[model samples]
Target: MAIKAVENKFKKFFYSRLSLFLLLLAVIWLSLVLVKTFYRRHQLDNEISSLKGEIDKLEKKHQELDQLISYVGSQDFLEKEAKDKLNLKKEGENVAMINESALGREVAGEAATTTSAQNPAGSNNENKLIQWWKFFFSR
Candidate 1:
């Protein structure tokens, strides 16, 4: 009978409110650790994705630079550069000389005529003195 009483006391201690409360606390702690682990994993995944995108963009730029290097080394590009920078020409080629001053005067005259036609009231011919007076004194 004494042994039975001891056994009952042991069972009551194991099933008491204090034990249940301690168990609940342990469960909450473990759940918080699990959630933190999952959040860190998600953050790492996003970082990896962004890094991969940057790598892809850099690789594409590297490919474009390689293509440009190849093009610059080609004969066509070299010939064009020589013709433009060195003023070189092939055999039997004729070169024309343009008078820039004459072209500029013609263009200016045409523009003035067009402006005068567009605004006839604003295009009256006035002497320089009259023009200066109007500019300084007119409201």
Candidate 2:
């Protein structure tokens, strides 16, 4: 009877320790699973935020391209390009072109007249070399 009681006490102690160990192991496994789940959720959130930024950039670019396309298709843009590049005039429009060489000569003549008026003693017919010599020597 004494031996039987000792065996029963030992069995009870062993089972209690085994149950405690199993419970501890289960708790550790659950902690690891929870930690892994949190890490994965954080990674997914970062990916989603990055994708949203990319989507916003793409949407802005799409809008810019749409505006460019609209401008390219506009009649005002086409008419301006035609008039400037192809020199096309509308019906009943008279295009007068001033002679660039004549305009330049007139401007040069006015400048010469003004300079000559400033220096009454200097002759307008004087050569450039003579004018330079007089300028350096007189100054």
Query: Best candidate per TM-score, number?
Result: 1
lDDT (tens digit, per residue) of candidate 2 on 25-130 = 9999999999999999999999999999999999999999999999989999998899989999889999998899999999999998898778746355466669
lDDT of 1 by residue, 12-128 (tens): 887999988998999999999999999999999999999999999999999999999999999999989988899998799887867899999999999988977776463455544
In model 2, what lDDT does residue 45 have?
Answer: 100
Clashing pairs in 1: none
lDDT of 2 at 33: 100
By summed lDDT, the worst window of 10 consecutive residues in model 2 runs over 120-129
In angstroms, how far off is 129's CA in candidate 1?
17
Local lDDT at 98 for model 1: 78
Worst 10 residues of 1 by lDDT: 120-129
Judged by lDDT, which candidate is best?
2
Tell me each candidate's TM-score: 0.67, 0.56
TM-score of 1: 0.67
